[model samples]
Target chain A: MIEVREDWCKGCNLCIERCPIDALEESDVLNRRGIRPPRLKKENECNYCRLCELICPDLAITVISDDPDEEEKKPVKKTLLTPVGGKIK
Target chain B: MVEIKTADELNKKFLREGMWPTIFCNGCGHGVVLEYTFWALEELGLDMDKVIFASGIGCSSRLPGYINADGLHTTHGRAIAFATGIKAADPDFHIIVFTGDGDCAGIGGNHFIHAARRNIDMTVIMINNFIYGMTGGQLAPTAPLGSVATTAPYGNIEHPFDICDLACALGANYVARWGVSHPYQPIKSIKEGLQKKGFSLLEFLAPCPTAYGRRNKLGDIKKHWAWYDDNTILIEDYEKIMTYGSEEEKEQVKDKIQLGVFQDIQKPGFFESYEKLVDRLKEKEAKTKEGKK
Candidate 1:
């Protein structure tokens, strides 16, 4: 399931733009800030890519999985790439 | 399957409590840059007490206020000057100065250049939104050529300053520029800047949708990001073009904003040199006293 913190959403449409599966769209209802926050259109079709969460400037979007077994897997450590003109470690 | 963490859970680790809902406008890229900064800080495992965030007057300067750490919200265009004094007094403190294009490249241009020349032990993150967002959309020093601004209603005739190139020219030990679209790169660049011993300048090309985008007819937030994606040419690719391509090709790519580190070298910071001078002076004084005795 995907949840959006209504108050924090700024109506950037970044999540809507980056959603690979067309799972999100701008809602007609305005939040307290008078901005139209994006809402999940097709919850079941979501692949849980987390692109919205990563791309969002505001930490408004949250993606949760229904499977309890997924929680038991250890988080993989991501190694950062060395910048250009700098030596790689 | 990857473990999914909620936004609150991840944000709460670095963000200061009670500062919920930042002052940034919808689709403003400053928030993304700040998030990347927090991620870098966490990766480095820096003690918040040991870090001092100093900022000048502008939209980006407001970042220091949001973070729960010691920060000096100094006068307009003087963040680097204040940070210099702070670093000189306490060399142990990790000083990071958050500035905007107008604040650093316009009013504080001299300080910015001199700080890099001195190679002070500090990190300077200049968020280039192209226009003076806080001061009602005035044209900034980094504003693109032909861009519209309040001050330049007829479209700007002046050329924009390439901050990364300028910093690299001034002998800055570390310098990098990243657009807001690239999340991972900026975080890594920030982390590398933090670890470097000398002056480090990380220029983040943030989208000021309310100020810059609307004025330039860039449409919504997505269009602004698309503009960044289309206009920018990575430094690595740029270098390859320069090496192999003809003069015509090079001129065609000239308008593209070069991203990535322009310079990163090991150098003695100002404080280290200052301490050496102090030690030399003390030894000379002792020698003179012995001679008199």
Candidate 2:
């Protein structure tokens, strides 16, 4: 699963363009900035390739998974753990 | 293994704390380029304090301010000249310049050419957005022929500049061009540019969605990226086409943006040549003194 920080999203649609599987779509609702942010359309199809994360200019998207093996692959560093209104894990 | 971190982690490590929210428009590729630069610097383990970032007036010029380093936001189109002075005075200081197409190729064309000709030790990152994005979408030197801008509403009739070709011809030690769609190549190119000894020019074909895109009917960021993906030709392929293909085939691929290291030669830099001249003069002076004695 991934989290889209609605506040930071500028509705660039780059994530939509680069997603290999059609797992993301533009939301009808606009964020505070009045730009429609993309949302995960098919959650199960997401392989966490992180193409969207790499291409996001605003750094608004974060790919999060509960798999411990995948977490071990990531660097051990202090990461920003919360979205807009969510609690830090 | 230097662990691979997320973009957010990298941002926290390198970006200025208070400067959250960049001024670049949504979907603008400037931020992506900046991110790649920061990543390159980080991977290289360069000390921020020892580096001097200089930029001229443009949307891309604002990049230095966000990097948390000693930066000179100089006058319009004079960043290269200012950086030249900085590099000449303190040859050890790692100098990096951020300039846009209009600022570097248009207003400061002479400086751009001369700097490359001199083969000074510095890395220049030119963001070619195809328009004067900050000053409201005026026609830029890098704008493609028949592209629409605010000044060229009907369509631009003027030809665009191939900056990489110009730099390569002028004897720059390193030269490369990459679009924003290919993230890995740009970062790799930038890293190579930073490591190079003499003049290095990295031209990034960025998108100005608000200014150039809206007017050209390519407002959608995805479409703009797709255009870049479709139009760009790899440098190796370009060379193959030029070498073996017929005149007709060459003409067919003429319009595609050739992307890769156009030049990388081991030539003595300006400063090194100057030092050699000084050493020769000193030796001659010593010889003259001995003769007089």
Candidate 3:
């Protein structure tokens, strides 16, 4: 499930531009900020990549998996690794 | 195993609930950087109680105030100095300094240099918006050549400081630069910076659409976001072009800023040396006392 907190969106449109599959689109209705926040236009087209969630500057978008069992799982803690250089491959 | 928490969960856990809808202007990159920090902190699973944030005066400095952790909103150009003191008092505490180009590279240039020189254990997340965003778009030290600003109405004639280059030269343990639009790299860099034992500098080329873009004719939010991807080149690509390419190809990337990890080396941090010095002096004092007895 995807949630777009209308009040929080500043209408950067970064999510719309960054959406890999064009799952999001500009909304016709304006939010409290007088800005047209992106809405989930093609929900089936969305792959749940969460790139929109990560790229949104306003922190307005959130993507949660539909499986209730997955939601119940506790946050996994990973050990820190020694600092290494280079770009992600 | 990876954490699958949503953005809402991370926000509720890390951000000050009252500070929602931050005072940032439309299309501001500061909030994006803050989100990256939250993601990095989450992935590392750091004890927030042991993490103390410090900031100098600027728009980016406002970041610490928004976070739910403890922090010091220090005077202009002194966040690194204050962070040094905090490090000296309690070496175990994780220090994260949030600063802007004007605050870190301009007003606090000396502090930044010395901190890196000493290899102080801290992560400096510098938001370089070219202009001083909060102060009516004044020309910052990091502003590129020919950029327009209130102070430089004609055009900026000054050559901008490549902060990552400066940090790498100063022997920082970790150094990387990324534009805010690139989501994952900044988060990974921030995480690496946190894990580093010595001074780490992460410079984010944030878009100041309101202050910088308006004056520079990049006011359109969409265009401004796209510009970062077009203007910057990966370090690997830059090197490949430089080493094995035609003159035309070389000239194409000559003006493009190189973005990637500039430096990462395992050097003993200042505290590690200080601890050794203290132990050595204590041993000498004990020997002298024994001889006297």
**Best-fitting candidate, scored by DockQ:** 3
Candidates, ranked, DockQ: 3, 1, 2
Candidate 1 residue lDDT tens string, B1-293? 22225655667665775787789888899888887788788778888899999999999999988888999999999999999999989999999999999999999999999999999999999999999999899999899889999999999999889888998888899999988876788889999999999999999989989999999999888778877876777888788978998888787676788888889898999988999999999999999999999
DockQ for every prediction shown: 0.31, 0.18, 0.32
Candidate 3 C-alpha error for residue A80, in Å: 33
Please provide, for model 3 over B236-272, each residue's C-alpha lDDT reduced to its tens digit, 9 standing for 90 to 100: 8889989997888888888887889889899999999
Clashing pairs in 2: none
* Top candidate when judged by TM-score against the true structure: 3
Q: In model 1 chain B, where is the ten-residue run with the lowest total lDDT?
A: B1-10
Candidate 1 lDDT, A1-89, residue by residue in tens = 67888998878888877676666788899999898988777545565767677678887777786687554433323422223322211
Listed in order, each prediction's TM-score against the native is 0.88, 0.87, 0.93
Error of 2 at B132 (Å): 0.7
Using alpha carbons, what is the TM-score of model 1?
0.88
CAPRI class of candidate 3: acceptable
Worst 10-residue lDDT window for candidate 3 chain B reads: B1-10
**Model 1 ranges with Cα > 4 A deviation:** A27-30, A39-49, A63-89, B1-6, B246-252, B291-293
Tens-digit lDDT string for candidate 2 (B1-293):
35445666666667785776778898899888887898788888887788999999999999998888899999999999999999989999999999999999999999999999999999999999999999988999888999988788899988888888899899999998888766677888899999988999999988888898888888487677666766777878778888998888788677777777789898889999999999999999999999999
Task: Name the better of 2 and 3 by lDDT.
Answer: 3
